[model samples]
Target: MEVNLIVETLKFLVLGMSTVFMFLALMVVVLELQAKIIMKYFPPPKENSLVSNSTQELFQKGNFSVVAAIAASIRSYKKKSK
Candidate 1:
């Protein structure tokens, strides 16, 4: 009877540990799946234009050539000016 009780206790202990491990594994899988789904549907925000207002003001004026030159400039001075 003592041997039987020991065997039963060991069985229950193993069963409890396995149940805990399975629950933790399931939780990790669920969290990973949720992260992947959120990443797939929700893209990161993009950088908006900082010089749109200035560009619009230049476009409104008759400085089309200046705008073109500024756009084609290699030193990015136009970006800094805005």
Candidate 2:
């Protein structure tokens, strides 16, 4: 009777361990699937900005005189602070 009890306890332990492992495996699969779906629809971010486009256009239009004047004004302001 003692031997039978030992055998039954061992069986229960094995079954419990297997159930835990199965649950962990299912969780991993679900996480991976969610990542794939999010990436497919949302995608990653980009670094492009409208300010950069406007700056490029300013350079192309020969507006350096305006830029120089603005820089000089900033320099004068800085000098006044000192």
Candidate 3:
């Protein structure tokens, strides 16, 4: 009876550890997939590109480049989340 109890406890401990590891691995995979999808759909464009050229002009005139600043912030936030 003593031997049986020890074996059963070991089995349960292994099962629980494996389940926890599987969940952690699944979460990592999901996060990677989400990042890939987002990057593919909403890629960051060049700083000198048309979208940013206008913002650049505004900056030269002493105006805050709100759009560029916001995009940079969002990109940094996502990167940090990973």
Candidate 4:
């Protein structure tokens, strides 16, 4: 019957969605656990003040133009890929 078909279609859709949701949830938990393990084992290196670029001046106009070109190419590439 039509009613049975609709109910079956809904059941299939629910099952597919639930499977995807559970998979994504599991991936999140696994990735979080991996991050914690890695961080605990290998701590990040300390940044020395002498070699830091924190107080550097802003980029020049030519550098800004180059960066804009790179950004445009990256955007176009991403659009093509998608």
Top TM-score model:
2
Q: List CA RMSD, all candidates.
A: 9.7, 7.1, 15.7, 17.0
As a TM-score, model 3 comes out at: 0.46
Residue-by-residue lDDT tens digits, candidate 2, 1-82: 3579888899999999999999999999999999999999988765433344353566676778766776798899999999
Best by lDDT: 3
Residue 56, model 3: lDDT of 62
Error of 3 at 8 (Å): 1.3
- The alpha-carbon lDDT assigned to residue 21 of candidate 4 equals 99
lDDT of 2 at 52: 45
lDDT of 3 by residue, 1-82 (tens): 3579888899999999999999999999999999999899988885655554465677785657575786798899999999
Residue-wise lDDT of candidate 4 within 1-82, one digit each (tens)?
Answer: 3578888899999999999999999999999999999899997776543443222221332356556666798899999999
Task: Arrange candidates, best TM-score first.
Answer: 2, 4, 1, 3
User: Which wins on TM-score, candidate 1 or candidate 4?
Assistant: 4
Please give the lDDT score at residue 49 for candidate 2: 33
* TM-score per candidate, chains pooled: 0.47, 0.55, 0.46, 0.53
CA deviation > 4 Å runs, candidate 2: 1-3, 44-74
Q: How high is the lDDT of residue 17 in model 1?
A: 100
Off by over 4 Å in 1: 1-3, 44-82
For residues 1-82, write the lDDT of model 1, one tens digit per residue.
2579888899999999999999999999999999999889996665443344465677776668867876788358767788
The pairs that clash in candidate 3 are none
